[model samples]
Target chain A: MPDLLSPALIMIVAAMAIGPAKGHLRTAVLLLAPLITLWAIWQVPDGVQGTVKFLSYNVEPVEGSALRRLFATVFALMVFVGGLYAFRLARWYELAAAYAYAAGAIGVCFAGDLIVLFLYWELMALFSTVVVWCGGTPAARAAGIRYAIMHLLGGVVLKVGIEGVLISTGSIEIRPLLATDFSTWMILCGILINAAAPPVSAWLADAYPEASPTGSVFLSAFTTKTAVLVLILLFPGEPVLIGVGLFMVVYGIVYALLENDIRRILAYSIVNQVGFMVCAVGIGTELALNGAAAHAFAHIIYKALLFMSAGVVIYRTGKTRCTELGGLYRTMPVTTICCIIGALAISSFPLTSGFTTKSLISLAAANEQMVWVYMTLTAASAGVFLHAGIKFPWFVFFQRDSGMRPKDAPWNMAAAMIIFAALCILLGVAPQWLYPFLPYPIEYEAYTAGKVVFYLQLLLFSGLAFFILLPLMKRTETISLDVDWLWRRAAPWLLQQGSRGLQPLLVFSASTWQSLEALSKRMAVNYLGQPETADSEERGLFARSWPIGATALWIAILLSAYVFIYYTD
Target chain B: MSDSDSQDFLSRPQTIRRLWWGFSIVLALTVAAQLVIYVKGYFVVDGWFGFGAVYGFLSCLLMVLAAKALGYFLKKPADFYQQDEDDA
Candidate 1:
């Protein structure tokens, strides 16, 4: 019990202590503390390690189970990678808040009961908003406020759902709750919103890109992936997620196909990848679950690598759009190479990390005999190559020569990319290492020859399509609209329209009140005269003379009237 | 790495040749690695099914070409959207 409490407290304190430092010291502390917390997390052997009871309600801070450990492991790794990208350039305050956010994520993953999960979940919401605000721009500040509001609303829904579930079910263990109750569905929706699932996914592309470059790198790792983890645990085999996941996948590709901004393209694709995970959770097979976990790990490294490369470009040239930048490969070869490696990995080119992991989820779909969904996933895979895989590097590095020749990324940045790229290839070649740690046992082979050949042909054909269709894929002045535009643009326009109509009614009411006051004042002054003031020296006639005489006369009259009435009756 | 020398590689294409050679070598090496895996399949009497090696190499080649082709469109003039003074 003390052991679990100790690590959470330790990580929280480490985060709080980060505010006082500056320069390299700040970076070191932020990066190092998570490593220690990670080690502490795995120190206990697996299965129910800590508990406390408050008579009716019992709580466990640490549930040393395989599922919990798997999530905690990834959360810890994210901390390190997030630190690597962020600490080098982020303000100490930002780094501090980021570490605190990470600690909260780890806390949630390790939590055994609903109450603890809710607490850590809200903490994650709180601290991540602080990190977003650290972008220190008007756009970031506004986006952060919106981001915070959305998360707080989600948190409230989740808390109410948790209470309801606890009351009805009489158990708070964080395991498969099924899709039976409104409370469970509400919880699922709340979590899905963080996962960047439909309708509200605009929050991610809108809010994330506005953050500081380092902040984006950190922001990319945690929120959606953690939701994937929760879904895997709680909603496995729920068939509805299959359709919902499919929607997210197609929506992501179509939106990204039309997007102009580079990071937002990546952001939408994050939804697409999590959609794959969500589908895997829905499939609920052994291979599907394993694939979801493996894909998540690979996605983290490659996505972070992608964001870091983008950050390096933005840091040097202060540009982010494909339209604004090009020909950088002339000087920044390392970054170009790094970005390409990340792209290939994302495209699931056969020998990269993505193929090794992502194939399992697709294979799981095939095994389930879901042909249409399977076909859509295959098409989405091709579209991934089209937008993110091809478009990102092509536009960023090698196009008709932007003639801006920034030097290669700073050494630390290059080191981070190289490490991730190596891991991408390593994992692809020797997937056995990743295979063991997945949430479920994986009986499927990722590198079957027939399957590999088919995938290559299909994806290569898609590459051909990308080049053939390049004319339609040009950068333009106008922003490509999405469901988010409905909120960020149309909703705001509607709100302004509403307020405009409201303005006249409010003004008319105020004017009417003023006119009524004027009429009353005019009537009093001209005809009735004002009442005596409160501080006048003499009493009024009504107050002083009437009460005693009136009381005696009224009493005698009432008695005579009563006697006459009684005789008449 | 100091900001003083950050502009050292700002105008050169020396890495361009290196990138070309390096990418070719990578293409070759990746294909060779997969070819070894493919050769073991030759003994199993499924010659028609033994296109994994070719498919693998072809995928790498396709990837690099896609790299070149995409390089055609989205890559723009570095100062394409910047203010005029920043361009100078």
Candidate 2:
């Protein structure tokens, strides 16, 4: 019988085991834990399976639904494959933190209440910062601090919303919430922060590239995608998300077009890809929701594949900027071919997973008669092909030879890439294999002759445009300023100036207090013969020695006035 | 998969000429495909002949130009953020 255990808990336990289990034993646990969790996920049936009471509220730790299963299944698979890619290359603690991070993602997947989900949300934030710090460079350490602060602030915002909801509604059930009230809007804000929605979107690009190569591959799989999942659950059909998602799509492309680092380009594209899922959630039809879910699944596969390929390049050559690397294809053909496949998949080229899945989103826009939206989405599709699909491979693999002939990917890394590459094509050819795993039943057809032709023309012509505009798209060693600059530079600068400006006021106040005490003491010594007052300052009019006759007359006048007024009232 | 053939194919001027011709032919085939496959146009302008090709090409040009314009304002020295950290 399948034990009723939270799969996330199993992975968390595996993380604990890794700290002391040395050498091969540690590898076995790292590899087996995710495999075991995969089995546990499959064994879960569609309903609430495990519940516990905490603080007079029932918290369901295992809620079996199609959406939860799909997300958990992919997350589990990512941990296993990401581990395979990392085991030979990464430090043991990095693997441990990564597994714990994956566990937190899985925990959120099965969480049936807002409180439980928030806990898992925090778990991910804590451990992912460690993964970023594992990069061990000064840059990584700084980036990780920024990353943690952003997520923690997001966590606090989410907690406040949860508290408000609990007080008002007297329930913690995770259910659909429209942004009709302050609490719901707060919840939406909190979730969008994690989704890398605008204003805060820079965190994704800012920190992700600073992580170790294996750390980045794992980072690519979770966080924003999980936010996409939660959005699908909580705020489907919220019309405002349509605008937000579109902004992200265009922003990602424009920034990616400007990016120089290989991984940072991939990072910007993550926001772009997640933008499609977010837009679909706003469409909120069964077809659109399925499109969102399926696209998330397909994206995790191909994006990780792309990042894995990039990781190998970084591992062997110790370089990441596009201006410094190229012509590696001659020696690293396997890595190059795998990268092209990943590129094609991300661009939704014909007979790849992206084509099979991303079309459903465009089709959803068309079905809704959103003419402007449909046009922009179609245009962005071509832009994706330009910035990520072509730019990544062309600049990193096929551009002007930097004369660096690094070795091909090691066995483990190559194995991981090959598996994902195969899945990209396999799912494209037979999408039915993935469709059944979606949150809704699949009724839409993906492949029509017209769509195939339309996409081919769009993506191919974009490629042609890329070659034509080759001179304009020159690589430069530069970084684009993002919203994080306000906090990173402007906020710090303002704080420093404020402190420096306040210093004189503080010193003046302290000296004035000392002088007052000295005068008061002198007055006390002279008049009252108290030693404690020997340094006291002279008092004002109220503290002067007054004649008894005058004081009594004044008190009598004030008392008479009060008594007269009181009697009249 | 010999080194000479691979090198000559990518490096030679003749190969470049052939590639351009091949690319033009493929573009022509896609334009021709519009005549045979009836696209269910989602909007009024979408039904125009070779509309997808024109729109795709023009949109790409616009995106690249827009991106380049934005890059002028947004791009900074790669060490812009790092300078403060090193100072600290």
lDDT of each: 0.75, 0.89
DockQ, per-model, please? 0.07, 0.53
Model 1's number of clashes is 5
**A286 in model 1: Cα distance from truth in Å?**
1.7
lDDT of 2 at B55: 78
Q: In candidate 2, what are the lDDT values of residues A151-247, reduced to their tens digit?
A: 9999998999888899999988888888888898888889999999988999999899999999999999999988999999899888888888899
Give per-residue CA lDDT, model 2, range B1-88, as digits (tens).
3445456456566877998999989988987898999777788687666777777787888889998999898889999988987777
| Each prediction's TM-score versus the true structure | 0.80, 0.90
- Report lDDT (Cα) of residue A416, candidate 2: 94
Residue-level lDDT for B28 in candidate 1: 48
- Give the Cα-based TM-score of candidate 2 against the true structure: 0.90
Candidate 1, CAPRI quality class derived from DockQ: incorrect
